[model samples]
Target: MDELTEFIQSNPDPRELKRALAVQMVLQEYTYFAIRDVLQVSVGFISKWKQAYEIQGVAGLALEHQGSVGYLDNEQRQAVIDWLKAKNYWNLNELQQHLEAVYDVVFASKQSYYELFSAAGISWKKTQKRNPKADPQAVERKKQEITDWLEQHRHQISSGELVVFFQDECHLLWGDLCGYVWGKTSERIEVPMSNERQKQTYYGAFNILSHKFFVQAFEQGNSEFTIAFLQALLAECPESRIALIWDGASYHRSQAVKDYLASVNQGLQESEWRITCIRFAPNDPRQNPVEDIWLQAKRFIREFYHLCQSFSTVKWLFEFVTHRQTFNFPKASMYGLFS
Candidate 1:
């Protein structure tokens, strides 16, 4: 019985795992009504799989196999493969239904269908992001512009007169902590989240020279908060000028921010401004290195989710790692090499 439970837990195929688990529960004296409530399967469904296992062992769980006596012939398998090739998408259930409907055949194992997918040159995969809004030419042009700007100001940066910072904001939701976790294969892993939407807004900056990350929590992102955060950043480094590179959020480019910049660098030229704000290309988040800083912080939350039961705990966890911590990633030096 222990071996059966272990087998059910170790099984990778979800369908087979369900069938095996249902049978295992029955043998363990779990009532049919209880199994029905737990597994969401009717009593008849449970009895069918249970009886099939009793008669044909593990092979009984499978819908069908190729050939007459539990296997399909060469021609029949080829037809199935061709049928699979005709579809742009594939899933185990769809394939099973197709085989059961067209040829009245069922493979004793899911591996048989995987073989069919392989023959059709179809491999299981997840979809990747393709950002249509990102303009390649604009991104390249901006990268070169940034490279030129950094090279031109190399002396000030080297002399510690100017500090370079990539700035961004993140909305950290309590729900973000609910991510993939390992548990017993037969059992479901549940996260205890009181309010999934409980969230905090943060302003963060990544220092290029030091690889250090700085962050501060804010009620929300707006013109007032943006300027206030900038003021806080200046207060931290009173002697050095700040070269702030960030995305073009509405607040970042608001009239209030412009007035704030103008007021600080009233008489100085653009090159000598106390705060030199550079905007990354529109809709291109890949240009900002601070993204990795936020990603790392979120990953930390996901890793230690059990510790972050409350919203206050989430904020503490974020600050504990992010405040003045140095983070060096490949994207940090995408525009210009820090070294």
Candidate 2:
């Protein structure tokens, strides 16, 4: 520890002094937070040099680029960029680890890492989703079918005698309190929950014609709940027949749900049925506009993670974002029925 202090005062290169100070701070029992604040370095930087000093003594704190302008040469930088380009997924920590292990280099600032990411044609952002089971052909065909079906109901919809709703279900848990936020890199962002497994199910619906969204919290998304949701939706628009569009969940098509719908439309012809359920393409959720509504509600709640400490608050936030709102998104009108 004394040797480290002497080395720090020996007027060595600024980079070497910074590294020695990190090792000395840890040995002097400085809190990681305090050390980071004073040194303007990450906790990883402190621990990395501390570990190096423990393994190789004061010599371990020496910087590879002590007199050099940059940590990596032009050729090495290209190699790092090439390695990053080879990966399908990436994160800052993974890249940092790679530089430390493969190139035996560590930058004092994150800007260097960000530069690498930028050079590799990458940036921190949300990931795109694609389902392997989704058939492009089936999706196109379903889109056409739904378009023709909506066109067929143009009269009823225009006359206000028929209401169309895109419906979906979401199971929210207590642990779903996370969302992307600007946060400290060295500090882990965590949401506290009493019971992470505590969950609630919600049946959601959106009307393309009216642009109105509706949601009901249910105990579970079983056949009974599905029927109840349908009954409630029918009651809301008492005079109009409801054309329900949703994904093909098994409970939605269960014999019990079928029997309920049959009873509701007992004497009417197929076209005149009081409640008609139309399913989106099997195993494909992207086609259902209601899926967007569900995701939006969840994202909205997650964004207010600090406020939603309890499940009840989460539920309130969920409904607050969804209920009585008009949803407008590009993919939402992909079926061209919203217009």
Instruction: Assess the local accuracy of residue 186 in candidate 1 as a C-alpha lDDT between 0 and 100.
Output: 100
Identify the candidate with maximal TM-score. Answer: 2
Clashing pairs in 2: none
- Off-target runs (Cα >4 Å) in candidate 1 are 1-90, 95-131
**Which residue pairs in candidate 1 have backbone atoms (N, alpha carbon, C) closer than 3 angstroms, thus clashing?**
63-106, 64-106, 64-107, 65-106, 65-107, 66-71, 66-72, 67-71, 67-72
Residue 124's lDDT within candidate 1 is: 77
Each model's TM-score, in the order given? Answer: 0.71, 0.73
lDDT of 2 by residue, 50-128 (tens): 8889999988877655444448889999999999999999888777766764566768899999999999999888776
Q: What is the C-alpha lDDT of each candidate?
A: 0.82, 0.83
**Worst lDDT window (10 residues) for model 1?**
62-71
Candidate 2 regions off by >4 Å? 1-66, 73-79, 91-105, 125-130, 183-190, 337-339
Q: How far is candidate 1 from the true structure (C-alpha RMSD, Å)?
A: 10.8
Q: What TM-score, to 2 decimals, does candidate 1 have?
A: 0.71
